[model samples]
Target: MIRKCRFAAMLAFSAMMSTAALVQAQAADLLSTLNSTHVLTIGTSNDAPLAYIDPQTKAAVGALPDLLRAALPLMGVKADVRAVAMPFSSLIPALQAGRIDMIGDGIYATAKRRQVIDFTSNTFYNPEALDVAKGNPDNLHQLSDLCGHSAGTYEGTTYVDQLKQASAACPAGKPIDIHLYPTIQNVFADLTAGRLNAGVVDSSLSAYALKQNPALSFELVADYKPADKAGSACAFGVTKGNDAFLAGFSKAYATMLADGTAAKIFTKWGLTPTSFFLSL
Candidate 1:
């Protein structure tokens, strides 16, 4: 009995030591390590104009990726930013799972999301808009206009909550028919096909798509009133509680904002810099 008890105690001690080592490994500060290792993994989606993988070159292109690339040298981070493309909804989970070092997409820095992940300072302000078939057939002008109509947006976006708010205010028996897709491109696809009455997405994203494909027979509601009083400030996301990385990256990002790097990136991507981006 005495020998068995001693063996059991040794096993328990070994297990505790292993658990402590795992916790320490998980909580490691990734900033200095990344700078030394020269590799950083990022998660992005098919969110174009902000971030996307170019099909032809298989390179990550767009305003967000460009900004991230520019900030690297400033922070002395020389890591090869490997871009991992996934559905929009998977970015956060992958980050939490330690599969990606950062998120290279235009994730809005809202209070709710901040609870789960950290974000760099606001990089740009983009307003929400309603995209509809050409000529605004249904005359949907604002959030409330979505009531009793088939409206769509991508999963894991702020627009989902916005649509729900509009639906709640709708008259009894008249709720906005909300549909969720994997990506904004899917939403636009159904909207142009006349399957969905409207699509609520970032105004800048919609405008960028139209500029890229003029034949896409959809139009933005002119003089549209948005559900929120103003737009949202979007930024790259990182794992929560990553103080070392967030501190270094945020300072470098601020330099990018101050030194005109951010504006130049937007222009390079055919995006106008007259918006609040310059002010950020």
Candidate 2:
């Protein structure tokens, strides 16, 4: 009887050990599959109210981060939002090389980028504008006004393409002299220094710059209509085949929209929130 009891106890111990191992294995597999702790890297510029690096904290704090924070929880993922500083022109290449997972700030979805990256549903739409030195000196009001005048823009941006298009259509000898800068700051600096008569950029960014330099006296030209089809919108860029991550992001985004979290963030940034299709 003693031998049998001892054997039964040993068998029970073995079963418990096997059960515990299985449970641990299952837990490990779940952890591996969920990607809960992976860093959700984002790229952005110093564009204020959108994705600027806070001077005090040296961290990204703006509309995009606020929105992402609200959406991340629904995915059962905790994101370590690291801002990878890069020129706006380099953003796409950085994304393709996996230097960053997504762009945190404003990005207009263009046909060229659609081939390599997938964009999340549009978050906010804003118009593009031209910034010129304060006063009516240039009398530059529209793209046509730029004929025979110098214009500066950030390289590799939609604004550059728009300027180029306008230039191409101009009558001979009436083409706008286009200057490409590596960064928006440089473009604006050149404008302030009178190196360029006007700088074309996103409206929100131009507003922020005006706020930063109240005495700068830069005015938005009145004649330049915002791009007709160029309603700039912010979207997340994911790898083309990243279905798991994409699905998770879409789910979280939907929850945020349904709960009005997305609207609140946009409102905080003084942006008009627009309805978006939630199909992942």
Candidate 3:
């Protein structure tokens, strides 16, 4: 009986080591798969100009998708990139769970996140802006303007914390009424429908979204003052310690940046690419 138990333990140990070796081998040469398999699974959110599933064609269309399709092949190999759309809050967990190979949801690689995943050089910087009904009906020109008014932002964004902080600073009886939505598009929907008094929006998204829907009732507060002038640094995410994927991707991206391919991608998406925003 003891011999049978020992044999069973040995089999379990062997199986565990085999699985570990397989995972490590896969991690070691993600770049080579670009040539042989030609498929890279990218996880993203339903955010426009960064990434979103097109309603008509049902394919991912945006700056990051375009850049990946254009730039990855410049690495001297073929790369067939695919984008998987998920909720804004599900991106990181999806990446960590290995449900996707990379994340391109305009995700920021802050210090806390860097501990779990590696990131290529920043892809963009997103500054926050304010939006309100036309003619500035609520006088919502700044963070302080949120008091006594219903305001909202996309969930899982740093902007949510900013809105909360602003709300906490409001007077005891008339705090900012804050709400969170699954996507920025939903937040804008509320604003246009007159359900939300104001919304904290991304500046680039402000241009792309409002331009796409000129008939929306709300308008960007062009002169809205913000508590923080500097915005967030956004990047593409991959599993931590995957050096081949990191080095190969960063090299390909740098090539695009030098050749103006990145700029054209941004311009086609209605936003201008900048060195300050797109570089190390």
Candidate 4:
């Protein structure tokens, strides 16, 4: 009888141990599925301040990356910033394809883009401007001056739309000849080569370019005015249906703004401090 009882007890013990092992395995699997690897992929064309490549490190390091780094940790996310060098036109398609998780580069929220991808709260505000050649040969002062002149702009940008609108309103026989380039550098190169009369771009970018090329002597001839009072606010583009990620990001971003961290980052990059969406 004693030997039988001991055998029964041993059997029970073995069963409990087996059950515990099974439970642990199940728990681990569940955790693995729930905890996604946090990676924040940012697309860039190397525009300064907004998004640019560090010449020495050859890595994307700019205001956008800094802002993402500050905000991600608050949501218990470990952000891995990956910079994908691509043309501005390809950014939306890349986001839709899941090639990138988000765009760290500054992108304005347009009604057309909103149809495809959702934009997070505004991170910065940038005005569109024109870059004219040295000595202001054409004496260009605004969009009206582009009439009958060849202008260059990055493909797939709102600047193209602005140029088209301006062209439509010009007098007969003075239509604007706007040239599109795959990259900003290409457009600048053409402008310098005299292929283009002017290069229209974001004011911040125009400032940065002029600073880099002292001899280029380019100046902003016009500033873009958004159709709405909201102005042109830059935001991160995220895939639709990721409500959880968006909510978390917004929360983290709000926290950063409330605490002045966002302002510091903006100041570091020489950007004007502006309120994030939540603060507004």
Higher-scoring candidate on lDDT, 1 or 2: 1
Flag clash pairs in model 1. none
Please give the lDDT score for candidate 1. 0.83
lDDT of 3 by residue, 1-280 (tens): 9999999999999999999999886566567756777887888877788887788887877888898888677667676677898878888899889898889877766787888888887667777879888898887788887888999898888788888888898998988888899988899889989999998978778778878889988888978765553447778888876787677778888878788888888888888545534542
Q: Which stretches of candidate 3 lie over 4 Å from their true place?
A: 1-16, 19-26, 225-231, 273-280
Better of 2 and 3 by lDDT: 3
Global fold similarity of model 3 (TM-score): 0.88
Model 3: weakest 10-residue lDDT segment is 271-280
Q: After superposition, how far is residue 69 of candidate 1 from its true place, in Å?
A: 1.1
Q: What lDDT score belongs to each candidate, Candidate 1 first?
A: 0.83, 0.74, 0.80, 0.74
- What local lDDT does model 2 show for residue 153? 88
- The sequence of per-residue lDDT tens digits that candidate 4 reaches over residues 1-280 is 9999999999999999999997774344211222466555678877787777787887768888888878777867775666887889888888777677677776888777889887877776766667787767987877878899999999988888888998999999998998999988888788887888888877667666776677664565644333433556778887665566667778888888789888888777665434422233
TM per prediction = 0.91, 0.79, 0.88, 0.79
Flag the better candidate by TM-score, 1 or 2: 1
Candidates arranged by TM-score, highest first: 1, 3, 4, 2
Clashes in each model (backbone N, CA, C under 3 Å)? 0, 4, 0, 0
What global local distance difference test value does model 3 have?
0.80
